[model samples]
Target: MAPNRREKGNTVSDSDPHFSGGGVAADGFDRFGTLPDCLLVSILSLLPIEDAVRTSVLSTRWRRLWTLAPLRLLDDSALRSEKFPNKKLLAFRAFHDEEQWRTQEGWRVRAIDGVLSAHAGPIRSCRLSRVYFHIPLLDGWIQTLSQKGVQDLAILIPMEKRFYLVHPSLIACQSLQSLELCYCRILKPTQPRPNLVNLRVLNLKRSLVTDAAINDLLSCCPALQSLALVHCAGLRRIHLRSPTLCIMMLDDYSWEVEELFVVDAPNLEHLMLGKNTTRRTHVKVLNAPKLELLGFLDMSIKMLQLGSTTCFEKSMVTLSTVVHSLKKLAIRVDFNDDLQADIVFDLLRCFPCLETLDVLIADMDDDDEPDVEYWKQQVSLDCLDHHLKSVTLKGFLGQRTDSGFVNFLIAKARVLKVMTLISVHAWKEGWVETVQQGLCLQNKASIDATVVFMKEKHEINQFQPWSSLF
Candidate 1:
């Protein structure tokens, strides 16, 4: 027996018209079906196009609900299931395997296009990466979306390697708050006044666009809050000067980028640079007073300039310059040789006000310790004594070089509160004892410090809070 639920209009009994063996609602009846139409439509809008359309078969009440909801389509491409190191390589191979994937892709495109045509409500978001990016088809779809008022749009084709000039409809979509494009090209704006004033987030990865195009885009996007250019080609120099921007990530590892200069970004906060993938020789932050999080600074940077005066060149590694605005920093270093201790210590000295330090270690074949004297000769850094509170060492294997750096931190960082050691799953038997001996935790300088050892990547992502922005 079940209880009868009463509403202003009617009552819901156990005999509700739900198929047998279906999910039991909270009230043991069709309570979910009683939610207001607006909420139900909103829920439907978030689902994949296929799943959203399937809801119509439930009953007459849900038959037309999908048409009243926003349409959202994504690129659930088969190739994306496997994590390829390089996306450009996938694009090159797509041509050879075109016939094998054509049949499935053709069906997918037709279904998406039909759904777009059938939708009677607003178009909130669309990501057409898996489908063929024929210019005429894309323009037609975008024309419909512009009329339906799409807010977020991502037109990415991983199989496209050559540059195709983005249709003017993409830039003219006045309703867009976020725009992301990959494997396409954006030419210099020909319009007298391009209309992307409402866009708040823009990400262009693995695309081809000139500096003039970038400058024009930025000039038009007065409300953009976040911007990312990852592995983009044709950028020789970058000088950011934005008033509304807050977060900017520039990863120029795929090609040679000569310089990156942050001329003026008054409200800027997070800045993510390239790691080992970078050949960016010179980096300078002329004015970004609100900057807090900065990461993956290449250890081999040729020139680093901050504010007006102090310049630290790779020619003089012994000298240091401070960046007081940056609270969190990430550095990439490798220990192929027996000695990486000197450079690490010197680099840490440059950030006196750093509160959290993330050290990314590259895996090397050799694990033997030839000399540990280089670690002992280094003097204590200002960050180690007072400011540094947390340290995260990624790819920790407890090698002599790894241990030496951990030992240096444990012995020097007097105000340290937490130290997380992330193992890359390379530890052998008796690893606990080996780490204990290697780190010398018993002789820690900061009595309040606590150490945590994590082996999984899922746990590591929790600390990376801003990864979702890009």
Candidate 2:
């Protein structure tokens, strides 16, 4: 203290008696001091509220850093240990003051509460993955986030026996733009918020939301652009009537809708239907003037009713219903070999203007007869016309029914360009390849066609060179 160190203009680290080899270098102070306030804030913004709060211990400069950070509320224990190997579970455990099993549960509740209380302003994004909390608390948290103008929300709730309710406040989020709910339960519709005019995207995959609830939610969002209801159970019918919806996808293994009414979607361009119950369902095609793409899978369309109820009870979809001004057509059927040849012919006849056709022709185990030169003579491709330039056949069993269609396609397609035949089930001794080679010899000018035989089940890949329009 002889000539006080501060007065002597020497740095504090140099003057300290205990600084001989303590490793408290002058650079340590500069590290925090040199960081721009904006950079510090941005770094803090990415941290979970609890982690952000711990910044205060770093230095006096970080005492109020977390107040400006975005809240990342998560069930701390629900986070698999595999993700963060360095995660100090002991620190969280101490805050929880419980055993390993019980501390995790307490951590989640505390983490959520800490984030909500600390976030004074609107949250830009919230990512809650595999979180478990009381339903009421979730509702309240959603309400809190909505009021604060949370924009992006990704919620993956724990699959519990109890139902989960979507709070009405969630829809009220005026700044909300994107929402993703996976494997969740929408127990009931919450109150509607007035600020949800800007919402655009909603994805509910493998969710437990009823049709009525979905309808109610959809009706509320007037500006919605994309809606994907994938494997959402309890929907027997979906009346999708949205003027602003450009893309609508319904892919549920248990989706057995008797009727799907598309009323006012004029701008709707892409419609995808997948894995529906084989039972009868009257699908009404609405006035989508701009419609261009339609894809279906595992669907047995028993009736093809156009604008009128004039029923055409066919197991497969007629080509007319598919190729109407559409550039891309995908048909994936799960039918038995018992299908009538006439029905298959009718299905092929409808695609007049189809430039690209990808058909998955699968048959039951009972279909073993491979020779079908005689049967091929009976099928007609005159109606199919010359529009088909590119075609793909998946799960081709090299049976009479499949080969019959192949030979007809080779002979009748006037402007055929490229054809890909893939054999599914064990190849009946190079059945598809044999057909491909035979077709090439008969029609050298019948466009470039190739067949690929999958020797094993795992060898079957996705239809290559085809863009999934949906």
Error of 2 at 47 (Å): 6.4
Considering only N, C-alpha and C atoms within 3 Å, which residue pairs clash in candidate 2? 168-190, 168-191, 174-195, 319-350, 319-351, 320-350
The digit string of per-residue lDDT tens for model 2 on 1-470 reads: 32232313545433344332223445433343555666777888877555676676654456666766654543344343432234565565456544563546555666666767776765777766633455556777887778777878877677762345556677667788888887777644655433457778888866788777778777778888888877677777778887788888766354556666677787788777653422355566656766666665333455544333222544543333543666566675533433444454554555456677677664545644433454455644543465667777777765556666666776766767777666544456555455655553475335454444444354434664223322
Off by over 4 Å in 1: 1-43, 51-65, 73-103, 131-135, 277-279, 308-313, 316-321, 334-343, 362-371, 397-402, 423-426, 452-470
Q: List the residue pairs that clash in candidate 1.
A: none
Q: TM-score of model 2 relative to the true fold?
A: 0.74
Candidate 1: C-alpha lDDT: 0.72
Q: Kindly list the per-residue Cα lDDT of model 1 for residues 121-192, writing each as its tens digit.
A: 598877777645455577788788888999988878654535666778778889999988888888778974
Relative to the unseen true structure, what is the Cα RMSD of model 1?
7.7
The 10 consecutive residues of candidate 1 with the worst lDDT sum are: 77-86
Q: What is the TM-score of each candidate against the true structure?
A: 0.77, 0.74
